[model samples]
Target: MDKEFFTPRTLGDAIGVSQSSLKRWADKGLLNVEKTAGGHRRIGMEEALRFIRESGVTVVKPDLLGLGSEDLEVQEDELSSADRLYYALHSGDETRVRSLVLNQYLDGRPLYEIFDEDIQPAMARIGLLWHDEVSGITIEHRAHDICLQVLADLRFRLPRVFTKGTAIGAAVPGDPYTLPTAMVSTALRGEGFSAVNLGPNLPIEALLDEAKKIKPVIAWLSVSHLRKAHILRTEIKELARELREQNTFLVMGGSQIHKLRLDRDPYVLIGKNIHELVSISRGLVANIPQSSESKGEFS
Candidate 1:
């Protein structure tokens, strides 16, 4: 798991500020901190990130926060993060991949933006490796696993609290790709939903069964590689109908989503990107009652 909290000195060091300055900010209530049982101060990642975003401070040492190294400090367009990520993934450098992702995340970039602008573009290029023969396929699979690792690290960095109602998702059977559904979970989490990723390659019947059991506020299906379009269409239609009956919105997306040729149903939503999915989910979450544990600092 990635580091979650930081002391005033550590955060100051990470951002190139003095402890005295950080303490001063805490004293002024500009930065929030919690005291340990022994009296030392600790800053949660949520608060530290908030302070950075609101104050426009540069993260000079994001690695201390489990993000990335000095390369993260460089301003964009020199190589472009997507380009860098493509090369890193192609080379199967898991550490570099993790750093690139965590750096953007701790820098307070939105999960949706990161997916749309960086990870997806890089992975799309990496996907071309499938045609490059067995060695290429091995590299592509390795890249996929590395990305999953980065997502896990990012998940750990998020606060343990999730006050929003449940938001569940999965990839239908034959769509073995996992990143899209996992990315959906992270984005919805960012929007304050308890996003439950049911994972990939689940049969439509099994997906419907789980959706019924979870009774989520919203359900998502990622269709990266669809098979038997007609059967899937029928299954998806039934899923949408069931979700609508429960007042749960059904959101679907992926490169192959259009193959479903979905019918006109108000509860059925089709998104072209993570940004659109989050936008819709955010609105749905607004109407659902927050759990008893919800707080002003909810993330």
Candidate 2:
């Protein structure tokens, strides 16, 4: 079978599990692994995903395992596009970046797919370059600006059905990443929700106030950094409680969300990727018969 393989360490890092835990799982046959000629263990991408889904483990890095996007036929094309975009961004080629993004949009690619399968993963790879000191801050900033502009353009062009309930999204304070929130907002919009994006670095109080005002059916928090985990945990707990009182569901995601070590709550939804976010949003929206009745009132 044609398959992708990951080293135990790489798989562990991608899934946020300890290497020892992965080895233990492998030993217990929870994970399907193969032995190389040198007796090194390697895990298949499909088996890893199966284990993750069955074990109820949240994947913090879906891109690493190629799990989010369903458009497999476009995978190679998207990867090539991402590589070109990365090179263009590094060179500060704004024209090329815009053309690449718009071309994908014009070719009938969904905004969420572009973001999830292409832009986000490319940015993540670029982030590694920054972290490793291979790329300077200026290049990173330029790339982010270009991505923001493209996402804004996409948001403007997205067709609004608004059959689903309102969604309010923000990146929690102390998490300076903007793209994750933008992706979530855009995906919600694409999924027929009236999505209000609160953008990045929003204080919990501000988000709470906005949630109260909007009374959104879904309130999404994107936590990209784990620096202020203690503070974030407190804010998230308080916000969840308030949202629960308001009868609004809270959806949380991002790379560092697993770090919070939160206990699962019935009203709080945790998504590992944009696909799951869309799925959760659809489920919640499906139950909101009121939105269907009052669609014209909001628009």
Candidate 3:
């Protein structure tokens, strides 16, 4: 057994693996390590024991000299990739965005999660700063464009044949912001629903046309701005009534809806969070209508 118990560098060097490889393995439940105050990863003796056991290697007395320092180096390389991505997003560095997105996709982080957690937060920060300084708009726009490109890269696994049940989502009028809608659309796709994303500036008529054409069991409207939501709600109420007659459920969300005054409109449902929307969608999927059952018209 090696004497140094909690030294990340020494142990990683001893094991001849990159620290990032060690971290990834750790993340996947293969090893244990202590993260230091300055965000550095350190390994302990118990962790080393666990790693050896998991690897099914002969438990010879561990020699620190022969393994080489590849582990620490690999860890650095992995961290470098994440760091570079963060830096590019923050600085509006477009040159490396495509390559970074491809690498991230290969690393197994879902595109929707990345857009929701990383890209959205990055844009929100930039947007807040842009209000105080005129130049911030350029940075915000660049980040947003790059994020859209990343979203476009996502390969949605559409069903080979026409499906009975599907879901539709869009941002309501005056809700030009699109990231949230995009995020929700991806989540729908992941949930096995054919999501027809109509993008921004969706009038009630256009939404109705889409709902009729797609014949989805569920329709989602996102409203990020409150004033626009107030205006859109009137239109949505009518559409909800119309959709309910056709046996379609209408769902509304976003910060705008969060602030709105909601009533007990059976035709309309409001989701407070992404999870709620997903649950509603799942229920809709499970309750799909059969061809023999004609949807009853509601008053």
TM-score head-to-head 1 vs 2, winner? 1
Worst 10 residues of 2 by lDDT: 67-76
Tens digits of per-residue lDDT for model 2, 9-81: 8888767888999889878978878988999989875466556655767555555654332232344454577
Quick one: best lDDT, which candidate?
A: 1
Residue pairs in collision within model 1: none
* TM per prediction: 0.88, 0.69, 0.61
Backbone clashes per model, in order? 0, 0, 9
Error of 3 at 200 (Å): 1.0
Candidates in order have lDDT scores of 0.82, 0.77, 0.63
* Tens digit per residue, CA lDDT, model 1, 48-85: 87688668898887778766574744544478878988
lDDT, model 2, position 65: 56
Evaluated at residue 67, the lDDT of candidate 1 is: 66
Backbone clash pairs for candidate 2 read: none
Off by over 4 Å in 1: 1-3, 73-77, 160-163, 286-299
lDDT of 2: 0.77
lDDT of 3 at 188: 69
Better of 1 and 3 by lDDT: 1
**Candidate 2 ranges beyond 4 A from true positions:** 1-79, 131-135, 291-294, 297-299
Q: Cα lDDT for residue 273, model 1?
A: 98
